[model samples]
Target: MSANPSPGSPRVALVTGTSSGIGAAVVKTLCDLGHQVLAVDFNPAGETVAEASGAAFFQADLTDAEACRAAVGDAVKRFGHVDILVNNAGIQHVESIESFPEAKWRQIIDLMLTAPFLLTQAAWPYMREGQWGRIINIASVHAQVASPGKAAYISAKHGLIGLTKTAALEGGEHGITANALCPAYVRTPLVDNQIADQARMHGMGEQEVIEKVMLKNAAVKRLIDPSEVASLVAYLASDQAGAVTGSSWNIDLGWTAQ
Candidate 1:
């Protein structure tokens, strides 16, 4: 065990989007390291995943600010303090700028970008109180690079990296660290849910979307596993990474190397 686990004890991690995929993997990763996790997601299925991971689950629609606040409150109530926050809640909408639905764009912005802000705003006090905190945002390669027909997604992800940098600056003096994980196409339900949509938009088969559309830019052509990302999260949330903050760590198969 490290010299100090979290805030004051075994770390308590609050991970959103825990219903499946990377979120579930993160919950397991943190738990295996002896941290208590509060898993939050609007999906009812999240409760099952939470149970399996031995985590406390909060079913919440994070698009609502109050719901964002309440989820953090529930985490504190369950574990007494929040030591780490993994802002992993998000949804994907694929469409060109000219035809994308306004409501869908707003929802994606609210859920993906706005929710992290509110959750961090709410969790900051607990972290500051303990003089220790970790904020990990699950951004995408879209945060730095872009593709056609994904105006909202690319925009939101780009903005998330900006937020990550700003938060890192503000949290530095308080023993709080904020960082973003920018991964290429990871084999998560989030990516699976988009295959049919990408196929329709690109006029290609689902497999083609995975190969050409998804992996085309990467030097290493493979879908990143959720466990691979989880391992990084575990390290960032650990005491050894205390000096690392305000950075966007890319696990993108050398996609951005060019």
Candidate 2:
């Protein structure tokens, strides 16, 4: 707790992509930490997570700039201000560069990279006024390394890291911190879908896909839990983390270490 009463008070956080997995876990974790949360996602499951956690819910397509702006404005309107923002809304398309559809590449980049920029820009005034803010981007190990296929996802994630760094620099002077979490493979709905798609692509079983594809590069032999990543998000949003900004913290279990 800080000398400023509002600094230690229960703050408002807006977490995008709360339909399931990492997003849902982050919403629950922030709520457990006593923050009023606005959980946003295009998926209907976001409503369920919000209800369970006592957080408000909003459905918005992040690829739409108007929708993204409205989501941030609505969070501010409902909560008086947004103290933190978790930019976790993302989608993956596994395809080689030669085979990847141009439209799909643009869509992935728009959601993962462009949307974070818009949300952060929209939220800057409120954060600057309060002299306190946290922005966490959920990037992936692909941001650091590459694998077969997944050209669009990797490119978008790499761009996200750049956005995270630039925003961190600009926000540092305003008591605002921005960072990215690059986790290898988390046991999320996103990974589950990847398992199925990889199985089909590699002619392997789903179990084989997990062992051979997802965990093959990690020193830790298990998929990282969504809750584990959520815990890190909460820590970064805490007052104690004021000094941590403009860094990509890897939760990749040594995937990038090798």
Candidate 3:
């Protein structure tokens, strides 16, 4: 027997940032595995992707607290209950601290850090009422370490881990597990957008940036596929992983191994 809800009782999964990249892969993976996923993203394209994946779509600007709450409310309204909450929605703004915009800093923190906290707060009742839950934050390896020119992104990611720990501590006796996945340089649009910035900063070709800058510390020396991260999300969201909480699971090709 599977160590999860029975085949007929699929978990109602709510995934943010499902328009593309790891979030999209996660939505597709959960749906393909027979879970009912509610895909949430501000992007209209997310609705199309969610529809194509046979998951319900809820469009919302996650930076807004009302929108965050609505995302959870809509999931509960549609699926009757939310069993898995995946905080994968995020944006990247790369610039030196001296040049970073205040608005951008607040924007990234609101979306990446504050939004997850809000969503978790909104979904707490459902998870608590049912006495079963899984909360997965799609944090980056930046959560553990730092690099230059990403002040807001790095700070928010680091804050997210702390939020994850607190959520885990509170939910431990309530049958809820909260954990974060820290992945490095996945082949996503987010990373694709940063290549040029990294290249200019390092005075190298884009390919050189990837080879020397991005993959330099990683033992595997290759970008991770979104599906690889999705697989870990699947494991973390499973009943078998009941004991895995308040942990930062890294899929960074051994970047942090050193």
Candidate 4:
């Protein structure tokens, strides 16, 4: 072990959406790597996942601006300083732009786009002090390509990419690198619900929706695994990835290769 802490050393990581799916996998992966992880999610059920993964849980509605800052503060209090941040909490609503509810659109933007910005701003000072940090925003393939429905999710993710680039530029001198991960449909509760919603909206079976609608543009014929995405997150959070920032790394299984 080294006397001084560095990016390669275990660091404090604050991850959002720790209840299930990609967020849960990220918490587990980071904790297994010996990082002190503070798992934040709106669901109280996440406490169990955190305990099982050897992470501390912070329950908060990140759509609330104050809650975003509080999550960073909680991480600092628990682990002394935050060295990594994973903004992965989100939900999807499948509806045409004209038919989508106004309130729901605002809610999605608040949670997906605004919360990440607030959390990043809150964590900036600590990382600047340490001269090292990683901010990974869990964007989707929709960040690059759009679909018929899912106007709100697509919009938020697109905006998140812009945020990631701007943060990366601003944090360059301070050694705080920011990047976005764009993955295709991962096998998550959120994507499962999205499949169901898409089927209902398109008047098709769920399997048909998955095959024809979801994988229509892809060369690969399967949904991505949460662990696969988590593996990438591990690399981005490592000292080796210090030079990789301000870019959206795609994990889509040949979805956009065409």
Candidate 5:
């Protein structure tokens, strides 16, 4: 458990992709726990998260380096300093190697991998100055295993694991920790989009896609809850998790167990 902040100390957290799903849940969880967060997304849903949680909201395309830096700067300007960063913004593309569009691959890699790198770089000075920070990258089970027609997503996630480890090693000296959460198929808007894409690609009904494409390899049948992932993110951001860096913690519902 994290130590409670002194009355009015209000820690500042920035959670990306707060428009919906896991990102929204994480913003709520952090707010309920007493952090003043900066919820960010390209979509307008971040404004809702901010309103409901009393967090500040920023609409920015994180794939743009300037936008990424400005978002982090905005949070620091408002909250005094940023204490935690959750890089949860991402998109998925489904295509075989032969058919995968070059542009799509670049877009996915830029959003999923490059954006985290830029955000983390921008947040580093603040964390180092405070000598405390938490950086949680939301990776996926694809970080560990291969899935057909998802080369770019898988590659970016896997690269994120590398970035997490390297950041952990470097940040530890400054009392900052970095880690990645690798969940399987969390019930989220992202997964919903993927289900539709997969169903069409495989010529199967959505139900068939869920059973075979999403859950077939998992030991547990049900999708993981967004709240569960949020709970883990909260723990990781806490003082109790200081020793838990350079790790890829899986919240997959037995997906990788097999």
Candidate 6:
């Protein structure tokens, strides 16, 4: 098991995509655990969410390499160092591979894959210096299995898992651990928008899309709550989970059982 931070010096965490959903829950969970947190997101609106959650907010477009580095710097500047890093900022583009816009593909890859790498590179030294760190990547069920009309998203998520393993391997000697979380559909704004898009694409009602498309693969047949994912994040971030590294934790409601 990992050792907890000394009293009066709470572990500092830097989490991205904090405007809503899993990111927001993560911020709250970390703060409640007595960790100092710096919430980073492209949306300025996240500042309010961060304030409410007792975390410092940094607004940056993580797709930009400089911005990614700046976010890590901002966290270190504010809290001395970052002990936990959550790369969760993501966007979805639902189109067939043939009709997928070149620009959209680039944007998705840049935001989801390249940005995480940039942020990890920037945070590595701090974690190495501190001799303890946790890197939790928010991947998707699509990372393990491909889906139609989501080439860019699936590709980025798959790449993220690879990055997690590499980080875990490199950071092992330095007391840092890295892992990925693969979740099925959650009740997030992003998923809500996806439901709409899928409905449009399939020419079905939104409820039908949710029942027939989103829940079709899951044995639970229900949308996952953001808090459920956050609870898993809490466990992975805990000192007790020190031995867990380079593993992908699935909160997918048995979707991948087949």
Error of 5 at 239 (Å): 0.6
Per-residue lDDT tens digits for candidate 3, residues 1-258, read: 113354346798999999999999999999998898999999998899898888999999999999999888888877787889999999988789999999999999999999999999998888877778899999999999999999999999999999999999999888999999999999998899899989887789999999998998999979999999999999998888999999999999999989
> Scored by CA lDDT, what does every candidate get?
0.91, 0.90, 0.92, 0.93, 0.90, 0.91
TM-scores of the models, in the given order? 0.96, 0.96, 0.96, 0.97, 0.95, 0.96
Tens digit of per-residue lDDT, candidate 1, span 1-258: 122243434698999999888999999999888899999999998899998988989999999999999999998887787889999988898888999999999999999999999999999888888788899999999999989888888888899998889989999988899999999989988899899999999899999998888988899989999999999999999888999999899999999999
Clashing pairs in 2: none
**Model 2 quality (TM-score):** 0.96
- How do these models rank on lDDT, best leading? 4, 3, 6, 1, 2, 5
Over 4 Å off in model 4, which ranges? 1-4
lDDT of 1 at 136: 98
TM-score for predicted model 3 compared with the true structure: 0.96
Local error of candidate 2 at residue 242 (angstroms): 0.4
Q: Write the per-residue lDDT of candidate 5 for residues 25-138, one digit (tens) a residue.
A: 999999998888999999986797678977789999987889999999998787777789999999988889999999999889988999999999998888888888899999
- Evaluate model 3: give its lDDT: 0.92
Q: Higher lDDT: candidate 1 or 4?
A: 4
Alpha-carbon shift of residue 222 in model 4 (angstroms)? 0.3
- As a whole number from 0 to 100, the lDDT of residue 173 in candidate 1 is 87
Comparison by lDDT, 4 against 5, better one: 4
Preferred candidate (lDDT higher): 2 or 6: 6
What pairs collide in candidate 1?
none
Q: Write the per-residue lDDT of candidate 2 for residues 127-232, one digit (tens) a residue.
A: 8888899999999999999888898889889999999999899999999999999999998889888998888878899999999998998898999999999999
lDDT of 6 by residue, 1-258 (tens): 234365345688899999999999999998998889999999999999999989999999987999999999998887777788999999998988889999999999999999999999998888887788889999999989998899999999999999999999999999899999999999999999998899888899999999999999999999999888888888888778789999998889899998
